[model samples]
Target: MNFAYELPWYRKFINESDLVFCDGFGVLWGAKLCGYCIKSDNRMTCPDYIENLALACEQENISLFLLAGKPGTVDKAIAKLKAIAPNLKVKGHHGYFEKIGDENEAIINEINKFRPDILYVGFGMPLQERWILDNLTRINAKVFLPLGACLDYYTDAVYRGPRWMTDRGFEWLTRLVIEPQRLWQRYLIGNPLFFYRVFRALIASSWKNYSKMSKFWRT
Candidate 1:
């Protein structure tokens, strides 16, 4: 949602997405702080879900198509997933092509031909979401999951912090420390902005509710 504040296209894509669950611990925290009764355990990161999802796909005979990371990274992730769930049928293509023109069309065609039951796009935030928005209608998949950088984590290309840090919601801090140069602006600046927006929205919601209550009593 912080990205949504500045990126109108991202906001629109998120609003249009069939499923927009809270993947960030900060988002879950903000919802709880604003009086939403969401269980902490109910909040899931992509890596966490991927572990279970692979097993479920194996049992259910669901096919998967992975799209993300540099050249070869998706292949490594696919190998690991196959090892974990040998029964799982999966294919993948790296996410390093021109966003427009023939290359993009070719990639979409490849995915459509594969006809995966689930398609996971992990080409980072707004980029992944934008790609989905652009080609979602043309993609032949029962489910489209915008995984951000989860594929990197699965391939061990990126560290998602230790279990302790993640369980305590300090994963962002760990990531900031690990990739300060690349991610400082995102975690350092964007986090505070996200919280501020959440606070303002919470206040607005409370005020609207109070007004409705007062009007109902008066009537």
Candidate 2:
């Protein structure tokens, strides 16, 4: 939401996505407030479904390429994933390289060489989205998935709180507690701002409807 609010291009990117799924409770609540019938079951966090996805990919013989996390995080995640789906064909690269010039070109060439069926890029929000938008034509992957900090959570590099809290939509609170210094602004200011925007939009929509009904009654 913060990304959408701050970056017009990011919002456009999401609006134009082939498919978008709710990853958190905030989005579900916002959609509900907007009169959309999104439910808790619609929320699909990566940590919760990654193993299942990996197993399915293995069974379907789909290859995956992970491009995110710190130097060792991707490898750790791949190891854990392979344990669950031993036959899963997957490769990974850390997300520390430059996204331009020869380095970026080389990275693109590497990915093209692999020609993975699915590419998971997780350098966090707008960065991942922007990278994909800029390189969509150059990349050969069939599916491009942007997952923020997913590798960190998958490899236990970052604690994802307890299942009870995460499942119930209090994961943001847990994250705020864990990385208060780094994430204070994101949850503190961003959460309220998101809901405020939703409510404002809802009110505007209601007013528009009310005006239309008033004219219909007068006629």
Candidate 3:
């Protein structure tokens, strides 16, 4: 019922209503394929985004409930958040506890206890999106976002591209230069595969429209 309109990045939905945020480039790109409108700050450093978020939380007194990626990452992220916004309130921040399917009660418990205004889900994309879509009905947060790699990015555990590169959409290469070990596969293999699928989807859509036009002409 809450997910009435077409939603884009989790941030837009997050700022406005009860929702969750999902991260990961491919997932966000896929949202584009689905014709959703979301703000894309491909150049944003993870810390910069969180720093502003911290300011918002402190100023607004809005509680943030975090679901961090990988084990132990949440604690580290909280520490970084505290450094950014000394007075920021993290109602609840925890590492991944529930697996893909075994997440209902765990997430619901936090929602009931914290009733956070913001729910930052750090699970990677597609997975984060799927999780939020499945569990949003049970969530109490007014906003939920699945910001992929954003946590690590914020902690400076990962490197962000230069502003100019990001503006020109060459940020992917910058990442390769910064952390090739972590990203080689994602860019070298993953991006090419994604492009293929995206082009295929576009072609298919064009063909569908052409077929419809032909039918109308015959009629």
Candidate 4:
């Protein structure tokens, strides 16, 4: 729900990504309007994917690692995941560390020793993405999932709203109501800017298609 625009590094990372999934309602809606073949259910946030991830890892015996969040949030998230899939092999660390300093090396060493199948990092945007890219080869994980503030949701450090509100895309509103001062810019300003870009893209796409059709007819 945050940082959909105005971050050049993030955009560059996203463009270079091999696998990209819509992480928010705004992204999903924009994709649909742009004629993508994505279903609404496919637009899952991090909290929405934890259970399925835990189950899959439990069944396949794939080790998992939670590598982000506030001081205690990763531990709380680990506990919550254990409740869902008790047999799932998982370890975690807090996301408050320097990416290029001693802290980063310590984290990489821990993760390399564990050799997790999937490493979920919730260091928030741009940072999480950059962290993975910076240490992509050093980390022995098969998959690196960037989950922004997902740990907070699992730990109840952040309220994710009820199902009904979230289903209808009012989750942003709920968040704004809960933490207005912290989230005002994200929702109030960023949300509108995101939509405006989506609308502009839709129009441009339509114009391009029409032009192509007109040229084809003339030929």
Pick the lDDT winner.
Answer: 2
Residue-level lDDT tens digits of model 3 in 132-199: 87777888888776676777666666666776765556768988988789779868987777767776
The sequence of per-residue lDDT tens digits that candidate 1 reaches over residues 96-206 is 899889999999899999999999998887888888888888989999998888888877888888899889889889888889998999988888888988889888999
If both were scored by TM-score, which would come out higher, candidate 2 or candidate 3? Answer: 2
lDDT of 4 by residue, 1-219 (tens): 244356676777777777887777888887887788889888878788788889999999999999888888888888888998999999999988888989889999999999999999888767788888889989899988898898898788988899999998899999999999988988898888887888888889899999999999999
Q: TM-scores, in order shown?
A: 0.90, 0.96, 0.62, 0.88
Q: What is residue 22's positional error in candidate 2, in angstroms?
A: 0.4
* lDDT for each residue of candidate 2 in 101-212, tens digit (9 for 90 to 100): 9999998999999999999999988899999999999999999999899889988899999989998889999899999999999899989999999999999999999999
Q: What lDDT does model 4 reach?
A: 0.86
User: How high is the CA lDDT of each candidate model?
Assistant: 0.88, 0.93, 0.68, 0.86
Instruction: Give the Å shift of residue 155 in candidate 2.
Output: 0.8
Greater-TM-score candidate between 3 and 4: 4
lDDT of 1: 0.88
Minimal lDDT window, size 10, model 2: 33-42
Model 3 alpha-carbon drift over 4 Å, by segment: 1-47, 100-104, 161-168, 174-185, 193-219
Of candidates 4 and 1, the better by lDDT: 1
